[model samples]
Target: MQRVRTAPRHIAFETRPAGKPLDAEWTQITTREFADQVSAFAKGLIASGVRAGDTVMIMAPTQYLWAVVDHAALFAGAVVVPVYDTASPAQLQAIIADARPVLAFTGTAVHGERLAQAATASGTEAPQLRLLDPDPAIPNDASLAGLAELGTTVTDAQLEERRLAATLDDVATIVYTSGTTGDPKGALITHRNLVGQVLNTAAAYSEVVQETGNTVLFLPLTHVLGRALQLICIANGMRVAHLSDPKEVVQSLAILRPTFLVVVPRVLEKIEDAAANSAREKKVLPLWRAAHRAAVAWGVHLEAMDRDPGARAPLGLRLRHALFDRVFYGKLRAVMGGRIDYLLSGAATLRPELARFFRGIGVPVIEGYGLTETTAPLTGGRPGSLVAGSVGTPLPGNAVRIADSGEVLAKGVGVFAGYRNPVHTEQAFVDGYFRTGDLGSLAPDGTLTLRGRLKHVIVTSTGRTVSPESWEQTVEQHPLVAHAALVGTDRPYLTALVVIDTEAATAWFRDRGDAPARALTEDGLVVCADGRLTEEISAAIHRANAAVSPSERVQAWEAVVIGEDRASEFVTPTMKLKRQALLDEAASITDGLYR
Candidate 1:
């Protein structure tokens, strides 16, 4: 397994079963077949009016079609715009208008029709839309079927020419950010940008991958994290097992047994809660608690062993590992396929307590940071370089600096070529560095310690400033709290609106002999309803507030009883707080405070 410097001639390469190793079954995509599909799709796209430099919008779930559509579009010298399949009609329309795509590849007729209707409603002329189902036998419109039929006649020469003609500077894709404020902006990324990120990431984790051959693909392909993972797999010849449903992640892991997984903090938090709940239900918590104490004791001894390179673990700890396998590590590992080399958590800050706990249990969780504009990751922790509270050193060829105002600025080839709108593009970059809007400082060792977002900072009337994001992260870490939003910019003190983690809250009520009620209402406050706060909850909020300065502490608070699946009034799709929206909804509360 050598490091690959150049992109493969066929972006879709041959993959086959490595029969000798049973675990290598996931690496089954053959280069021949992949090349055939790429060639055929590219020809059909061109035959259907797609041309060089044209834009193609791709809206589909994480599946083989996503890869096909992206590669085919690239081969035809077209810019690709990948949209989340779950995007609202309004969001889809906005992206379509901004990109002004010449064609759209969709997963179903309903989705295509929705896009069409949205375009008509928005009064924007739409491109030719085509839909293809996962099942080949499903009948499609004559136009789409005709394109699909041409797959059989595409030649290898066409794919080769397309690849040869593609320059490193050519725009490969336009990724729209899940806007926290307004319509998402398209970030133009070239082939060089993506390839650089993949290569740099691969280099950072080469040691871990040297011993493992598989990586799990679960993030949305619409996101840069997912797209980067796909490229890394292709560049490194690693196998991928795609999982879309969050509920099926553990089950999929059992089947795929991937060596590594790149996931968001929410996913890891869910696993932690599930494991804890399982332990409690099985009456293993007490025993596991004792085991945890012993594990800590054994950890100290292991540290001593490390001082002597040739030393081995003592007999007592070895016996404990065997005895506690089922109660502790075994169950935890089973949920993660029992074979993960390392887990990379990004997209959001992971609680340090959770990261340390996972590491103590033999699962190393590395927390990192990046954005869509940075092509997913600018910094990540390596094996021994793991930092519990910091997003590790910047990737090779990347430079990170802190502005005077504490904003994190980055410059590198991995940085995107500005937003599609010139005004946004101008505002995004300061000098040549992309202003990340995140406030952070660089450690002596180069690790980036994230504080919070500059734009999200709350300034009190007394002139004290606070980053509500840090408090939000702290509150969300609680088992009962699913999401949190901190408010009070020029008022008395900070207050939060929180959504309970539904499953955890239901179980919490069930254990107390209470029948679970229907989902909480959006914008409905979740106080005691008797107009009193519980001592336990009060203590928790006080503790969270104590972590910040006195002026930043919550003087008053209320929870909105939002339904689990309803359009979140206080949160965005990426789970970012919709601060302005929350402020607007809580106007009555704020006004009452003043009186």
Candidate 2:
């Protein structure tokens, strides 16, 4: 309503029609149009026996329909629940058993079926199921059009009464955490938590959420940060386009040419890797390497300058950077729409070099830090202070501190009321601050530099404690290395299960333009046992080792050529390594090296 009042004609959202070209012009939805639709859907919800405080589960990808349903649920004064589209039937069942919503809506037949099965197994009556995108295959109460038809019976006064009855203190959503190291727990996020966070974040980082600025949302709405950002776009009336599929990111960017974009570290890594692999294929590896060095150098210089006013780049470095910007950087920018100013990254740490390279290319990454309990961001990059390695300072009205045990503690408006399970909620907080379970240090200015997850710390048989983050992140930055999971708990020393970047590795090997490369598919991911690629892996390990003491250095590692299996058993849907699963196999692979 406020968005409509301020910007009646402003395009609040954009969406591409299904089966359309990725670069096609988006279908814009104005503020008034979106509000009218949401109101109609809310009337339908109320007419269908939904009352205030009732839960509505949304299990779908990031799409326009998902946004409409989310707002509509809020308009009806119901508590919304989000489930990732990647969820298996079992995971879906677990959350359904926990949340026990009154209705559920999904974008596809597969998720609809999964939710149906989950609800059946939840041991309670199944919720009223609806489809956002109409599916004849899966039976449902109604589709979007059918819901609008249902709303014609409900009066405007009824919808208003329901919407106004809800309060900020009421539980607005039950957000389940991504189970990286443990089981997903339902965190009860109140309206205050959600609205307070977006308002404060917008005030603190107005540059990112400006009215004229726009961005594409590719991350799943199941994540707290994704939902928070969606709300921010609505509250600020920022133009937003939805891209459900990650594969179409390039085309979407080329078409939208947004001012800033939201991203995770993995996205940044893949972008740089794609460029490098393209260079290798074109026989311009040497030129690309020189340009890459210049970009990283330039980024490092800028970061130094950001921290200290007097810091400056050398004359030679400046000359090299300018030359490379014209010769190489411009082309790279062209691939990503040529208008990106900043990338907002969260959920994981970005390696220093990777972060610097992007900044060098003129798109600085603004890394933020928080969890589901924090309602997305506890700390984020301010406009003027961009810490290259840190997760910026706390947002307005939020505070972060390190406990005696090195765990990060947070207390703020963004912090959720509590977890759905009271016992879990009790364990999550200390005296007043929520136990973040992340180990981080705060500078005098309040910038937070994280070490690693407190639970991720590894202990060797020799009684030495090692945080695997630095080693894993350093190794992962290598062009050929996709992911590295360090394992050494109660063992003699550390070793890693390294995932070789098959696509990048194949391009690297095929640059010879020889018969071997032509027959590479039959060869099944050849790693060149004694060639430059092997040497490079060794060099990456060496670099990783240099960052740690003798005991903490990864002594040896086994390369796992992962392909087709995007998220194999060793990795979660979020791309986090299932450490316990790796630890189970670590002994089998590392017995020879340690023995």
Predicted structure with the largest lDDT when compared to the true one: 2
TM-score, prediction 2 = 0.93
What residue pairs clash in candidate 2, if any at all? none
lDDT of 2 at 313: 90
Superposed Cα deviation of residue 482, candidate 2 (Å):
2.7
lDDT of 2 by residue, 383-496 (tens): 557777889999998999999999999999999999878999899999899999899998988889998989889899999898888889988988788778888888888887
Best by TM-score: 2
TM-score per model over all chains: 0.87, 0.93
The whole-model lDDT of each prediction reads 0.72, 0.82
Backbone clashes in model 1, listed as residue pairs: 13-31, 14-30, 14-31, 15-29, 15-30, 15-31, 521-561
User: Which stretches of candidate 2 lie above 4 Å from their native place?
Assistant: 134-140, 307-312, 502-536, 561-573, 581-595
Residue 281 miss distance in model 1 (angstroms): 1.3
